[model samples]
Target: MVVFKKFNLDKQSIEVPGTRVQGATGHYRHASYVNGLVEHIAEAPHIKTLYDLFQNSVTKYGDREFLGHRPYNTVAQTYSGYTWQTYAQINQRVNAFGSGLMHLNEVILQNPQLNRWSLGIWALGRPEWYISEMSCNFFNLVSVALYDTLGPDAVEYIVGHAEIPVIVCSGNHVSTLLQNASQMPGLRAIISMDSLQDTVPVPGATSPAKILRAWGEEKGIKVFDFDEIENFGAEFPRKHLPPLEDEVASLCYTSGTTGQPKGAMLTHKNFVATVATNREGLSIYLPLAHIYGRVVDTNATFSGCKIGYFRGDVALLMEDIQELRPTFFPTVPRLLNRIYAKIVASTIEAPGLVGALSRHAVATKLANLEAGKGVHHPLWDRLLFNKIKMALGGRVEVLLTGSAPIAKEVLNFMRIAFCCVVTEGYGATEGMATATVTLSDEYIPGHVGCPRAGCEIKLVDVPEMNYLVTDKPYPRGEIHIRGATVFKGYFKDEKNTRDTVDSEGWLASGDIGFVDNRGCFTIIDRKKNIFKLAQGEYIAPEKIENILMARCNLIQQIYVDGNSLESTLVTVVVPEPETFLPFANAITGSQVGLGDNVGLAKLCRNPQVNAAFLKELDKAGQAGGLRGFEFVKRMHLTTDAFTVENGMMTPTFKVRRPQVSAHFREQVQAMYADIHASTPAAKL
Candidate 1:
């Protein structure tokens, strides 16, 4: 029952992947599976809950490094390298933290919500974050995650609705909690990860300690440092209250602008059954508020793997990775795309016969990638791509990316360049990070591989989009997921839960994709964020944008917005520095590069450059098979990248259309106005 094929790297070769599930289809119509219904491939049958998983790991691997983080020096205002905590140390703290929450102030023991008190964790991925989350599982309390970047308004809604009486948060988040503390009637206490004397104030922001003292006093809510709670719990110990398999372990709130956030209820069984599976220290970076991050951490902990946190600085992220030397690298496409661009740009700048050799090596490796070799070339890997491989720690054996669709070319480029298993996963928050990840053995470029173990995927027809199961080439429809991996329901959201997961338990994924001949799914369109033009052509901007990105590396991120009353479309693009800067300098006869923000910002709005860039976009779109109506009629170029902080992008790097539209409303209107004045100029 070995799920993975054993390999001997000494032989200079790795085992093939996903071979056990080749050509596997499911019982349901258009359904797909990695290994079908034959036991889900999860070997840890005894691990029924996160509580059990941790206990087992602690018993077996007590001396092993459980979690590690870089200590930020307040005096020097810089971070040192990683400091680790052993499994035994972490286990002791987990007990103390859970004990305090349950025994003191009757936190979970008398929640008044069936003794199922909900604790809120609002922070990035850190030791304290993971500890508090695990404490909830150990004590049978529900851990509710507030999106790391959510403002006071959304946090207020989630806090009030979930009736979270106590919130464990990072120092920076204390100010946000204080903003609406009075509105949260059920809230009784706040636990800050940093000490009041030590909480450093961010630029232009009030001190967290001051807000805590002021607001906590005014609201009659108790405030305690994270260490205080742990010490208190140790002093007044309580017995562990492990959860039942069916009990909800977490209340994860979904982020969107459509309506109030709906909490996705994930049970111990739902999670334990799926995870029970990872690597051998994960270089963690994704937010723990996300299911992807949480589950990855869960899997890593279960396997007794060390987890390292980034130094909380995006600028020095690569430096942290270089120091950590992680064997497994898990990240989102946005980050990987940046890394890919840097490598490609470096190859382009190599002056001499070296440049020609690099180009030839790229072509040869790409050909090898298409043939299912998968990041392996006896000659090229060690000789040509060793430096690129070393960039991600010199020991990265696995590379996984998810959250949004990655450019096909980028996917292939990464596979060849990283010299590792480069995979892309597809899933959503509601799915409990439910996914279909590409197999390392699969040579396919655009497809997210077949259904993962413990889950099943099917396609339901969307008539308006002209997608149906009966269509040829492949069946096209809305993606539906069902199985142990999917969330049971949304907390207290019966209507939404019912709407999302029908009687059959198939969770309607709102996304559109088609099952390929290999039983893989290539995400094509989304049901939401779709609009019809005045002449009546439905356009999936994401599909169009993905096409543009695959064909044109110059375009970093693109947003195509159109008025239903208008006959044409317009776009705002964030271009890659390496690709766009050279193009810009060539056309404008001016030299501008990264770090010259003022010059780059001004060049982004140059009319001549914008006009020329539009034609370049046209050529790319045409190459990707875009029709005349689908072509972008006008475009605005931007040096500014959309981000979660700007409210223009999601954590997963997908642009929030509503936010993007609002931010660019004036620019969008101006583009439309110009298009209207040049009515005769519109063409493919």
Candidate 2:
């Protein structure tokens, strides 16, 4: 076993080869697309400023789709929105709002107490963009986006943090904000884009439009409709530009990765560069609301591909896909799995007894895949895969998954079922849009693939920083990225900004990963979660955790620990309620949600479930995949999954290690307690 004197990593052997060439080949010409991309970048104004990119987009694809939205759940009932040519008009309306704000500034001059400029947005997707763009362009105001899913406390926290002066939300998002609107002292006017006449009968129900009118009358503030100003811009030619690249466009709060969400001041340049790098095809099932979706929208527009927007329940994903027939899909693993599950469920639901036969047929196809017979699904395709395809709008050429790790089984099933590739991409809000698995090239299931064109992927070794450093062959360490895609820095967070972006401009990804021999990068895990056992062997919990997540559906959350004490590697697992409920053979459903944790844990320890878990663990450990030292020796199931509300998971859904450890501290102690109690008997 390797023992380390320091906590930080000293050396790593993973690296991206300087160039992919024959052993003796000197050089080769750049690919044609590479040349075209470079030319595009060059002929493109230095974009020394972020506004330049917007101007360029407007100039080149003025009539193209910029931002769009539609009704939630309805497929054919979609809408294509105004382009950048109209974006100028949109800006003018925003400027008019700013002009109204300028009027409000005069009123503020009299009051002298009002100094903060904060704006809030609540519209589901497209309207959020309009308000955000307007806020950034007109007043240089900082806008805080509240996640519609959050409760009053989350909304209150953002309002308190940003000290917002103006709250702009659509009908859908305003009601929630109103729950805590009175708490925000600086909140002056609430503007509603959605007609709220019907909702006004309820206690917290009034249109922001009506609210704004009443508030403006009381405070001598002026209000304007977005549509009115939009019309005015078209009638009158208005040409005014905002600040340069250095100017902050939006204050994007972190996904609350830590305890509380810290606002990252993303400049226009940062967002533009991110958007530029993220330009890709838009297929069915992606909304322009997310950062990923926004990037896809820009990329599709530049690439001259039309994007179809769906604003409905993701539950109707099949209907949307079947109706839209999009060629590209950017999604997370969960959605894809659900689609596959739907396929499986649908197959089993059809033809009564024959549903069982159809399922067996699908299984036989997967078995054939393992035997290297190579993707021949005759009966399943006719009976099963076709429905899945039609449900997805039938023309998906590729599916892109990212954000979290995905199970290989899920990836393989989708690829085989859809006859399309499922590739993965990796990046952070800080990295903007640095690395991605390209669609035009080869596909690797687990690896995040190579750096996008023109990206410099280097692993920095900092043994003193608790990060592994290696330069043996393919250098492995912290993934340091320098590319057009990296963000400028965190908003007003000097220490974090300094820590994140090095003097040389390499952005520390915080994620620990390595490039394999093929130049394909695989994320091992988070650096902070990497721990060493008492025996001096370091273990990455994520690798083991990912395996467990894939192989054991019964385990919802797994935390591997053997760092400080070591009789054997141990884990705290949370049971999947749906999977474990059947095993309990419950007494007429005894109050489940919270009350079932103890029962669930005991069931996990039951002979059948324990054997299943151990068998899978051994199979995974011996799969020639994980290092021997990293194998799990002992494990215990927990009651619940780590969640954001409980402070165990980040908003982005990544585990909070410290929080998880704290929550499971007692359980961990008990595991060791039982182990020590049983030690004497084991010795005999």
Q: Which predicted model would earn the best TM-score?
A: 1
Candidate 2, residues 440-476, lDDT tens digits: the string is 3333356676555434566655464444444445445
Which window of 10 residues has the lowest lDDT sum in candidate 2? 1-10
lDDT of 2 at 113: 35
Tens digits of per-residue lDDT for model 1 on 82-178? 8889999999999998888776557533545545889999888889999999999888989998874344677898999998988999888776676
**CA shift at 552, candidate 2, in angstroms?**
28
TM-score of each: 0.73, 0.62
* lDDT value, candidate 2, whole model: 0.55
Report every candidate's CA lDDT.
Answer: 0.74, 0.55
Looking at model 1, report the run of 10 residues with the lowest lDDT sum: 7-16
Q: How many backbone clashes can be found in candidate 2?
A: 22
All predictions: root-mean-square deviation over Cα?
Answer: 13.0, 14.0
